[model samples]
Structures are given as structure tokens and as C-alpha cells.
Target: MSTYTPGESFAHRLDPRSKLAVQAGFAVAALAHTTVPGLAVLTGVCAAILLAARTHPARALADLRLLLPFLVLLPVVEGATLGPPWFSVADARAPALASYRTLLVVLVSVAYVRTTPVRESRAAVQRLVPGKPGRVLGTGVALVFRNLAVFRGDLRRAREASAARLGDERPLVDRMRLVATAGLARALGRTETLSLAMRARCLSWNPTLPPLALARVDVPVLALACTLFTWGLL
Candidate 1:
């Protein structure tokens, strides 16, 4: 998802720090739950977040479509693996539990990723690093995340271009050569241009923070996030 400025909502207005805590706390709660009650509580938490946030549930859920397959398969595969052996196929239960645990973790991460802007998320990380090193690292993270869509688009275009040449039926090596070369060359040229632009702007070094002032909005935003995180523990 593009990390544009989110719609103005209570969630969007939160300080980067509170938002970060909420995201982290949500993840911890996701991993801590396995029973029906645990899953219900976690699901309720996500539902409430979806309701209160600036994010459109449809779009955020669409971003999560990537997880659909695993959610479907985990229970099925696990049950299958454990069902045999004359009424007790004990083998599959472990994998099932493991898969479910992983799925919960992934779902929680998707929520965080969809809600938080890449720039804001990275800036929240800056407190630990400080100075030029922190800024550069943060900006680099933002830049990489910003490019995900462009690179994915380029991959699709490359495949389409090869298919146009009837190259899809070609030998695996030949087809891969076309796709990889096309995609990598595009990424390389873009990186070169980006490097030159950064040098021209003297952004070769770390970026400086803008002079904007933090507003009163940040206070309660942080307060509630801390409260919610503590609530999750209880």
C-alpha cells in the first residue's frame, strides 16, 4: 500500500510513538492467544481498530488478501496430518499449532504495515539511533518501502513484455534471463538516478528533521496507546 498521508482521524492523529506502541502491542497480543477466547479477544481488538482508524476496512482487508491461503490451509493441512494412525495421528497437531501461531503473527503485522506510513514508522525508530546515522537509516527504510510498488509493477511489465514475444514457452533459462535482466536493469538505472539526485541535494549525508512543532494532539494519543498496551497485558 502507498504510504500517503492518512485521512484525518483520531488514529491518524496519534504521535508516531503511540502508534508504534499500539502496533507492537497488537502483535504481542496476537502471538499470545490460541484458545477461542484469545482469538475472539484479538479479533475484537482488530475490529475495534478498523472501526476507529482512518483506514478503510475494505482496503485494509484487501491488503490482507495475501494471507487468505494460509488461513484456509493451516487447519485443513493440520487436521489431515493428524487424523490417521488408527484414530490418533498425533503427528499433525504440532504443525497445526505452529501454523496458527505464525498466521496470527502475520495478520497482526499486516495491520501495522497497512496503518502506519513508512516515513512515520521509520522516524519513530530514529529516537534510538539519533544524529545523522539515524536519519539516513530511517530515510533509507522509507525509500525502500516507497519503491515496493514500482518494483512490483516493473516485474509485471517485464513478464508481459516477454509473453508478447511468445517467450513464455521458451526454455526456463531463456525466459528467466529475459525477466530478470529486464527487471534488474530497470532497478539499477533508477537507483543511479536516485543517487545522483541525492548527491545534488547534498542528501548524500543523513537528512535533517524538519522544524515543525509537535502539537497537543500528540499527548493523549500517546497516553491512550500506553493504556491500551497495558490493557492487553491484563
Candidate 2:
């Protein structure tokens, strides 16, 4: 999904630090539970968070399309490897639980990503972590998130151009190779240009991040997050 969708929802107004905390705590708690009911509760909480964030369910599902094949294959592979029967319902439980937990984590992360801006994320990290190192780490992280969309766009355009030129006549492998080459070239070029720009601007080890303020609305969300996390742990 787009790292940050512009919205006026309560989630969008919450501090990024709160979102990060909730995501981390929820992930840790969710992983400890293996039961279907427990996972279902965790998934429900994530879904509620998404709803609170005003995130479109369709958009979230669309973003996960890239992982659908892996999600489908993981349970199958896990079930097959565990026992004699290739598709035992018993064998599938563990894998299914694991996959469900993973999905919950992704959903929580998507909620944070959709609501918080990259700058806010950086500021959150910076505030939580003291010193120049925190600044460096936070800036690095924000830059990565910022650049991810650009990289995706580059790959997409490259593939589209390749397809248009070749008209699907070329073999799949050839098309993939061409796309990969183009994407790598574009990434490298971007890196070089970015490096030069940073150098010209006199890159600092400790860049300033904008300040983040948590308001009253964040309290209820924080409380909900804590409740969910504790529930998952129990």
C-alpha cells in the first residue's frame, strides 16, 4: 500500500510513536498464541484498528496480492512436510495458526504505514532514541520508506515499457531479465544522483527531525492497543 494515505481519521492524528509501540507489542503478544480463537481475536483487533484508521479494506487486500501465493503455499508446504498425509487437517493447524499470526502482524503494520507520514515515523524514532545515532537511524529508515515507492514505480514502468515493446512475444524469462536489468540500472542511477546531492548539501550525521506531539485522542487508541496486547498475551 502507499506508505501514507492522506486521511483525517483518528489513527492519522495519533502519534507515530504510539502506533510503533502498539505494533511491536501486539506482534510479540500475538506470536505467543497458537490457538485459532486467540489468532482470531488478534485478527479482529487488527481489523478494528484498520477500520479506525479509515483504511479501505479493498486497498489493503490489493496490497497483499503480492503475498497471496506465498500465503497459500506456506500452509501446504508446512502440512506436507510435517507428516505422511500430504494434506492432513491436523497437520494444517500449526501452519494455519502461524500464517494467521503473520497476517495479523502485516495488517497492524499496514495500519501504521497507511496512517503515519514518513517524517512522523522518523521523528518518532528520533524522539524515542536519544542522540546522534538515533537521528541517523531514524533518517535512514525514513529514507528507505520514502524510496520504496519510487523503486516500485521504476519497476512498474520498466515492465510496462518492456511489455509494450515486446508485445508479449518474448519468453517470460527474457521479459523478466529485461525488467530486472532496467530496474537495477535505474536504482543505481538514482543512488549515484542521491549521493551527489547529499554530498553537495553537506550531509550531517545528525539530521534534525520534526517534533511529534501526542494529543488527547491518542489516549483511547493507546489504551485499546494495550488492552489488545494484554489480551493476546493472556
Top candidate by TM-score: 2
Per-candidate TM equals: 0.71, 0.90
lDDT of 2 by residue, 1-234 (tens): 458889999888888988887887788778777787778777777888889899877778787877767877888876775445556777777877787788778878888898988888888888888988788888798878989889889999999998888736898888888989999999999999989998999987666666788889878768877876776567
Measured by TM-score, how close is model 2 to the native structure? 0.90
Q: Show the colliding residue pairs in model 2.
A: none
| lDDT tens digits, residue span 96-190, model 1 | 55565555555445555555677676766676578888877778777877887788689789999999989899999999899999999999988
Pairs that clash in candidate 1: none
Instruction: State the lDDT at 135 in candidate 1.
Output: 76
Task: Please give the CA lDDT of all the candidate structures.
Answer: 0.66, 0.82
TM-score of model number 1: 0.71
